[model samples]
Target: MNGLSGMREENERLEGEVSRLRTELSQAAAGDGGGEKVNELLGEREAIQAKVEAMLDALAEIDPEIAAAVAG
Candidate 1:
């Protein structure tokens, strides 16, 4: 019961993080900034996206329905 609750909490947290990271990535892409800065943001976004994917993978094991909702 506690473990299920914890998984739900973690799932929500990861979903929020993924949303925030995606918003940041979109904003960064929209900006007309320096090439170096854009490249840096792209790298950061890639790292964040990777983390999100990993979290979703773990979540799928704990709760496939929630994971599918998040992924979709």
Candidate 2:
């Protein structure tokens, strides 16, 4: 039970972090920059976003209890 609760909390935290990263990426994308670092960050952000989404999907399929706990 404690483990499940901890997992739920971690999941929520990760979701929030991913949301912030997406927002940051969007803001950075709008800025005027022409460098490989910017391109790399954009790409990394996109990949991380996709992975986070995929993780959410997988968790949803794998555990109904955790999904309900983590979901709004």
Candidate 3:
């Protein structure tokens, strides 16, 4: 696949992961889950966020103006 298509797929996967982690975090906060579970969810969210940032950075390398607009 092309660069943008590959990145779009990665972005979608990461966004899905982030959404799932947020749901788990909320459930933990609601007391349906434990401290360890909450911590795990938080870690997963952080990892996904890092990946998204990296992808954005790559996009910036491809087109700084567009990336800046998207980042905003």
List lDDT for all candidates, in order: 0.69, 0.68, 0.84
C-alpha lDDT (0 to 100) for residue 51 of candidate 2? 69
Worst 10 residues of 3 by lDDT: 25-34
**How large an RMSD does model 2 have?**
4.9
lDDT of 1 by residue, 7-55 (tens): 5676577668767766766777777774566677677767766875776
Q: After superposition, how far is residue 66 of candidate 1 from its true place, in Å?
A: 2.6
| Full candidate order by TM-score, most accurate first | 3, 1, 2
* Residue 51 shift from truth in candidate 1, angstroms: 0.5
1-72 per-residue lDDT for model 3 (tens digits) = 369889999889888888888887888888954788988888888888888888888889998896878878
TM-score of 1: 0.52
TM-score of each: 0.52, 0.50, 0.82
Better by lDDT, candidate 2 or 1? 1
Model 2 Cα lDDT, one tens digit per residue, 1-72: 245466567668767876776676677677766345457767776776686666666677778975786597
Q: Can you give the lDDT of residue 44 in candidate 1?
A: 70
Report the number of backbone clashes for model 1.
0
Q: How well does candidate 3 match the true structure in TM-score terms?
A: 0.82
